[model samples]
Target: MKPGTLRVWSQVHTWSSLASTAFLLILCLTGLPLIFHDEIDALGKAHKIEQWDEAQLVPLDHAVDVALAKRPGEVPIYLSFDEDRPVVNITSGRSADVPEAEMGFQPIDRRGAVAAGGGQTGGVTDFLLDLHKDLLLGQGGMYFIGLVGLLFVAATVSGIVLYAPFARKAGFAKVRRAKAPRIGWLDWHNLVGGVTLAWALVVGLTGTINTLADPITAWWRADALAHLTSGEGGAVQPYRSGLVQKAVANAMAKAPGMRPQFVAFPGSPFSSGDHYAVFLQGATPLTKKLLTPVMVDARTGEVDAIAPMPWYMKGLLLAQPLHFGDYGGLAMKLVWTLLDLAMIWLLGTGLYLWLGRIRKRAR
Candidate 1:
């Protein structure tokens, strides 16, 4: 790189890193626990359901009815089945458009109409996840975090550009321990940053993409839903029936070799006012994260359309598990944890070096 170009890249690296350092620190701290969120959640004593014959499983409609009986005046928003056990988890709220905070969740045994667990939400892990996701500021916070992720990416790229020149001068991974403290820290930062560059870039870019989830969903709904419901009338009509179970069955019949991951009731965000959107997933690990939506006519309980997610929506779906290292099982999560720790160290040392420079300038 030319001298002027190198100087510009150096300044870019410095400012971008400085701008996002604090938020990045918070993300690292919160994200570490979240990397093992499944394991941590497993630590809780779960209500065990005895194995039951699949043929004897209770109907989905019955399960929803049983769940709604517990929460009076509430309506079912979503119904999801457990892959490992004969249990159905139902989410209910005052209305379809109610806030998540107003929603209630219940796990019901499919073998028998039994409440498997108490309705609960908001725990330590959820708190950490919320903080890691959006700083608890909802949509606006997500946009802010997305901006920070962009800055982090900028820092990473600029650092890589600057590292080429530094490596040629100082040799790769050379930590000048005998030099001044700031110099030593700077050397350590460069070395560690270089070592973790690829992982950092992947996480930063995916995190940024993940932050656009709401808008992406909105776009998918606006475009895909419009296309799917074009002939049925532009406006969503009020659904007439409550054949939730039949709708799911119809969707499954339409999508052979796929299993229902979740069902979005009519008038819900994931469904039109006249259809039940049953999201299906494949049996494999990777495909489990990638969902296909099957829209069933709520009034007639017949298949309306089978809509595969758009490329961008699929990207968002795939990016989520990749961002969290959830697709590769425990081994990958361990690798993610170690990488997260290294990132924390890099952020800390970078901050230390920047402050040291500021102090010297003051003197």
Candidate 2:
């Protein structure tokens, strides 16, 4: 390459890579184990085959009572249902609505037995996953990580656009000899960055989209759900949600084959005492992650079809797995993980190259 042209392209590569490398490194490192979170969770009592009374399920609140009993001092923060098993999750933490502390989690089965040892963490691994996604920052962390992911996507796109000039038959796979000063690092950059482009771009873009989710949810509430729930005065008063067990039962009745993924109880910013919205999760290759909400009259327990997610939600739902590489089978997942490592390598080398640039100028 000509000297002037080389300088220009070098600057392009440097600035673009530098702009996102630090955040990208954090993302790449944090995301590695998260890619295999299922494997890790599986190791920590994620599933089981236990006996249950198909005739009468332990009531939602009652099952929660079982979990709370199992962990005496803990508050029941979040309750999750089992898709196949008779497992019920009772998280012990202060309610976001009713302010508390220490969310201990327990799992209970159909016969009202807390599972032998469910919700046990793998310590460092669990911490890593949580930190990777949320930086131990809760909602604030999620949003901050999301912004980093967006910058990553921008870097990846600009990097790829510049690749057309750098790509060569050998360059695509090249690692130029140390005999050449600039050529070697340049070759390494193209090789590392090019090879991992698919994975990095995926993680970057998807994570970016995932970050946009909070805003998207707010938008959905403002745009789509508002129409579905008109003239309700926005559930401002925190009404003590009554008969949650019944509301859950009614939600199940409404979404027969579908599954209840989550619930927005009364007094929740999402719902109020007058109504409850149960998100019915879909089951399909593509639709599984998509949520279909069913609203119930909290007092009367009538189920109403909740409005569809806006275009943004749909995009987010799809983008998440593509970015996380969670949908595909084991082999594909492995490929995604390997690529995740590659992204880490790219970020590392990209950082070193930029540092080298700065030091040379300083010299």
Candidate 3:
């Protein structure tokens, strides 16, 4: 690129990075612990399951009933399984459209005993999640952060563009530490940014997609969900524990290899008014994030059809794990943490360089 062109790109890199740096730093800091959320959660609430005979395991329907009984006037929205223990986590809400903040989580052991129960009011991790997701601005905050993500992408690209010229002249890792402080930090920033380029781009792009979750889900509910339940319109039936179990069974029968992740109740945003949406996922590491919704007749408990999620919805689901860097094993999480630290350093140096330039101009 010509020096003029390079200077223009530099300007873009400067402002773009500067504009999004603060928010991106916050996201990186918050996201650090989130990468190890499972580990942290286990550390916070350590519980051991008593060894029980197979016969002691309670029916899923009975567990759901138990969870519902604990929260009178509430409905079962989702039932999640624990991987390490024979524990079933039930999420109950006031209605099908209850906000996530208002939902309750109740954990039941294999013997149908309440294991852990609590309100869904998130604590520190939840606060970090909300801050990283949308600055606690709800959906609007998500969009704002998404905009910042786009800016980060642009900044990354511009940095790459500028790096080409610099790398051609000097070793990619050369930091010029013997020079002025500003020069040394600039070199360090360039080196770190280049090293973490791919990770930064992946996290940035995936994060941008994750921000579209609400819109994508809303569209699916209006389009795919509407088409699925078009001819079966009637008064929405209340979810019955027995029918829910039957629905779960029917869903597994249809999708032989998949397991139930959650069941969206009739009239819920994720399900049609006339059907139960049993969301199933594969058993493998990669396919686990890909959810397939099996629509079951809420009134009759008969399997209707497996709703094919659109590419956009699939991308959103896939982006979440990728953005969080939770898909890979412990090694991957360690690498992600290191990359996060590098990005933080990159941001700090970029800020320092920008301020130094301003100081020079003032002089």
lDDT of 1 by residue, 169-252 (tens): 778999788878777788788898999998899899999999999889888887897577553533444433358879888888
TM-score for all models, in order of appearance: 0.94, 0.80, 0.92
Off-target runs (Cα >4 Å) in candidate 1 are 46-50, 178-181, 231-242
Clashing pairs in 2: 75-92, 77-91, 92-103, 92-104, 93-103, 94-100
How much lDDT does each candidate structure score?
Answer: 0.86, 0.67, 0.84
Error of 1 at 163 (Å): 0.5
Superposed model 3: Cα runs more than 4 Å off: 47-55, 113-121, 230-234
Query: Residue by residue across 1-363, what tens digits does model 2's lDDT show?
Result: 566875675566566567667766777777777778778777745475656676677667677666666665544445667666777766554442453234466777756454635667557677886787777888788888877777666666656656666675445676658556666776677777766777677667777677777678767766666666664644432323345577677777766677777666544435543566777776776556877766677666677556656678888888878887877778988888788777777777777766787798999
Q: Clashing pairs in model 3?
A: none
Per-residue lDDT over 1-363 for candidate 3, one digit per residue giving the tens place of the 0 to 100 score: 778998999999999998999999999899999888767766656566546565788778888888888899998877777655777788889887789878888888756566654334567777888999999899899999999999999999999899887777767899787878777787888889898888899899999988988888999888877777675665667867688778888999999889888888887778887788998999887678888899999878898888668888888888888898886789989999999989988888888888989999999
Best by TM-score: 1
Candidate 2 residue runs with Cα over 4 Å from true position: 1-13, 44-53, 65-78, 91-104, 113-116, 120-122, 137-141, 168-181, 234-242, 252-256, 355-363
